[model samples]
Target chain A: AQSVTQLDSQVPVFEEAPVELRCNYSSSVSVYLFWYVQYPNQGLQLLLKYLSGSTLVKGINGFEAEFNKSQTSFHLRKPSVHISDTAEYFCAVTNDYKLSFGAGTTVTVRA
Target chain B: DVKVTQSSRYLVKRTGEKVFLECVQDMDHENMFWYRQDPGLGLRLIYFSYDVKMKEKGDIPEGYSVSREKKERFSLILESASTNQTSMYLCASLSQGTNYGYTFGSGTRLTVV
Candidate 1:
């Protein structure tokens, strides 16, 4: 079975500041990684994904994640964040068709 | 736009009552999933369907059952609703040979009292 571990439960950042959410996964075989964001009272939307080929994957809203095979980590980062970036972010990993998600990290951007 | 739709945004049911959470997707996807969201637990899969009339148990399937009579519709049924079953229920769909990236519905907040 595959599992994901998000290091931070919550992160607070100032506007225009950089932010990074750490994520690690446990899988013996090849795995796929993804990040999703959930706004208040809304469903989750895809942030980015690491399927194959590139280690650095760029997603919507100027967010990106790096898939480090050696570290078994796929961390999400943004050069600068805005107030609208306040939401809950989840890290997920999958070896099979099913995905296993971390507990999630709540990012709060203060102006 | 192509999206997944859950029947209700919020639902309140009594204990031991039968409850149904309906989900529909318009993308002609072959995979549909049911999950429950809690405060600390990000999301726990309840059930999933790969094709019409085909179902599979996810991480947590206890006290939950699912029906997929049609390709677009997947229903999650609670035979006997319990207080512990109160949570945000989400529906998602995807194509085969894919993982992680899914189109999720708005979700249904169910309260069992």
Candidate 2:
């Protein structure tokens, strides 16, 4: 079984400020990592994923995440944030066919 | 765009009533999943099907059952709805390989009274 841990429950940042949301996972076998963002009353949309290759994965909305194997971390980062970026973010891991998700991190970008 | 559609956006049901949440994917994906999302708990998988009539239990499958008679449709069933079962249910589908991301439905908010 695979599991994901989102270190922070909530993070507040001022608009145009940089922010990072930490995530870690535990898996016995090789896994794929993903970041998903959900806006209020809407479904989740894929931000980015780490299947293989470059450790740094770039996603939409100028978001990027670094996959650190030794640390078992896939942290999401944005150089500057907008109020539109305020949403609930989830980190997920999948080993074979099933996906394991983290509790989630709520990012609040205050204007 | 790949679209995953859930039958209802909101549903109110009495306790002990049978509840069915339907999900349909327009894409011919091989894997479909049913999950419930709760505050501070993210999304917990209830059941997933790799193919028609093939189902596998997920992390929180104790209170739910699933049916996948067709390739594009997956249904989540609550035999007896309880107050605790009231939550937002999400459905997602993915292709066979690992490169594609799962497309999710808007979700169904179920309230048991």
Q: Which candidate is the best by DockQ?
A: 2
TM-score of 2: 0.98
Candidate 2 structure quality by residue, lDDT tens digits, B1-38: 78899999999999999999999999888899999999
Top-TM-score candidate index = 2
Candidate 1 residue-wise lDDT, B12-82, digit = tens? 99999999999999978888999999987899889999999999999999999999999999999999999
- How well does candidate 2 score on lDDT at residue A96? 81
Candidate 1 wrong stretches, greater than 4 Å: B97-100
**Model 2 lDDT tens row, A1-111:** 888999999999999999999999997677889999999878899999999999999999999999999899999999999999999999999988688899999999999
Error of 2 at B97 (Å): 3.3
Q: How do the residues A1-111 of candidate 1 rate in per-residue lDDT, one tens digit apiece?
A: 788999999999999999999999998899988999999999999999998999999999999999999999999999999999999999988777777889999999999
